[model samples]
Target: MDEQQGRARRPGGRSARVRAAVHQAVTELVRERGYGNFAVGDIAARAGVADTSLYRRWGNLQALLSDVLLTRLNAQSPMPDTGSLAGDLRTHAANVAREVTGPDGLALVRLTLALSGEGQQGLQARDELLADRTRQLQAMLDRARGRGEDPPDVLEVLDHLLAPIYMRVLFGAGPLTPDYLDGLVDRLLA
Candidate 1:
């Protein structure tokens, strides 16, 4: 067996086992120790991997954590298409809410925000994350246009529907409920 397979066999060959362990260790370290306070050696020790292995795979803590955020958390949230703007948007908002309020999502947002304070590179990564979602939403808007149901400025409508959910998540000030999502859809469709 290869090294990754050997590691996986210990826990029923789940690929996530090792990745999850590493992600958890890095997340906890960042929360308890702060980003700048830890090094690659420290992360490797916490993750129970050799420093060389960690470096060879992820290159840096930021990239590793970003992978964890994207793969484990964000990737699990389903984006729905419901044949109408209101239906689709409500579904999307609900999915976003579910992810943003979860423990992993909060940790990811915290890490991303902390990393973003470092300068251009961090900001670029943060933007890239958001850009991916924006592109997805834009595609949905395009689909709506092709069906002749979209407004003139579909992008703006999508932003208006989604921005509040993001604000609530970032500020930790409000719940993202189905009612709220429905209201957002109503406003956007109105």
Candidate 2:
């Protein structure tokens, strides 16, 4: 219901600010402590929201884990589809470089990989995220193939395309600059 029409609604207005805050709190806490030892009370306090609301919405940490991680990796970002393989790869590399180098992105990714072995649900979420990314990348390659480019070995290209970015993000091997992204694309394409 639209509040401007004077209809009744929840207290946080239409932007769902409380919901986002709670989810962010969850993400931060998970990044810090994984999913095992934290209490709902602590989470609620951290979020500055009611514990009841958190429980009512998330039920448990793993469910919220699935929602936030999968959303960030799969749905929150758009895949590059610039109609040419080189252009698409450059765009993809740049976007990923931006995301992985950011504070929240690095923490979330580190937490996801670090915590995946703790539970089946998290493992499944990680698996789904990987599959989603693979499908998106494959679509880009398939588009190039349709445009009369050589039939690409998608997996081989994926390694060549993503490894340097991951190494830079995870190990601080290099800066995630446009030069780095362009270099990766050039080397892969060459």
Candidate 3:
């Protein structure tokens, strides 16, 4: 909802205030301290809301963090549609590379990997966070197919295209330069 619509519905409701405060605090904390060492109490203090409020809203730190991560991801870079498969793929890969190379993004990835291996909840959260990007790529591929251009398997294309970008970010192999992104697009299109 837009800001006016949100305000009209609640008009300074306590629940809305608490939710907004918690979200803001979580985002700030993640950007500052990384997700590896965040505590509920710290978030509550930062938000100036009771710990119970957060617990009631999110159930646990993991769930709250997952929501926050997904929100930020969606806001930072929306997947673009450039009309051409090569253009669209390059744009998508470049956006991913930019995020993965950032400090906040690296922390999010580490937290996601660690949590996702623990149980079904974590895995579900990970899948939810990735669903938008997955759909975006799939739509781009579908558009290409409709235009009589046969691309490789969508998942294979994503994995092959994103592998080097992740490697460079996760392993500190090299910088995520335009040249690297261009090379990835060329290889994928070939």
Candidate 4:
């Protein structure tokens, strides 16, 4: 290929821009209209792309939503690997708190919840999302075990740590104070 063709094929080109725009549009629409209110055409208009592009790339709205949620989840919460499990748990908890409370946080959470009820496609996406998160948690727990630390099971961590944070966010309980987060980690570890 010529240099011009190679440059045209470079990473982070029009394809990346289109994907980013579409993801942002989905996030905004979910925040504004909630899930299931908008269709792929709406997303295309908002993202300045053709509806066919979205359909061709993602197959359907559920697939696109799944991609957006998964991308946001992966981008927002990276696993922490401090030497001690406590440190890792604390960091992970804090990262979750921040994401759930961030500008697009509520929308993503609502999208996840909504996806679970949409039908077979939604159900599959929801299951995939849950599995992805479970895998992340299990990896951290495995690391703790490898270091000779006794760690709780993945469900325990989800139930005791993440569930509470999500509940607070959903219910508008209060700010996720550092003390409260640390307390959750400490209690789980105890």
Give the Cα lDDT of each candidate: 0.68, 0.69, 0.75, 0.86
Tens digit of per-residue lDDT, candidate 1, span 1-190: 2575356446544455656678778778877886667877887788787888776666566666666566555466655678876677777778777876775556555766776886775676667665666667777777777788854364665467656777778887677778877888788778
Candidate 1 wrong stretches, greater than 4 Å:
1-18, 30-37, 151-159, 169-175
Candidate 3, superposed: residue stretches over 4 Å from native? 1-19, 31-33
How do the residues 1-190 of candidate 4 rate in per-residue lDDT, one tens digit apiece?
2453354336689877787799889888987888989999999999999999888777778878877887778878888988889999999999999998988767556777788778888888778777877898899999999999999999999899999999999999999999999999999989
Clashing pairs in 2: none
TM-score of 3: 0.78
How do the candidates rank by lDDT, highest first? 4, 3, 2, 1
Please give each candidate's TM-score.
Answer: 0.72, 0.70, 0.78, 0.86
lDDT of 3 at 148: 84
Model 2 C-alpha lDDT per residue in residues 1-190, reported as the tens digit of each score: 1342232124567336665676688777877886666777877899787777765665555555655665576554568778788888888888777777766657456656745865776676667556767788888888899998753476766688777787767886867878878987888877
Please tell me which predicted candidate would have the highest TM-score against the true structure. 4
RMSD of 3: 4.0
How well does candidate 1 score on lDDT at residue 32? 86
lDDT of 3 at 77: 62
lDDT of 3 by residue, 1-190 (tens): 2563355248478766776787799878877886656788999999998888677667677777776776677767676778878877788888888788776667556667856775876777677667766776687788988988876667776578777777778888878889889888888778
The best candidate by lDDT is 4
lDDT of 3: 0.75
Candidate 4 overall Cα lDDT vs. reference?
0.86
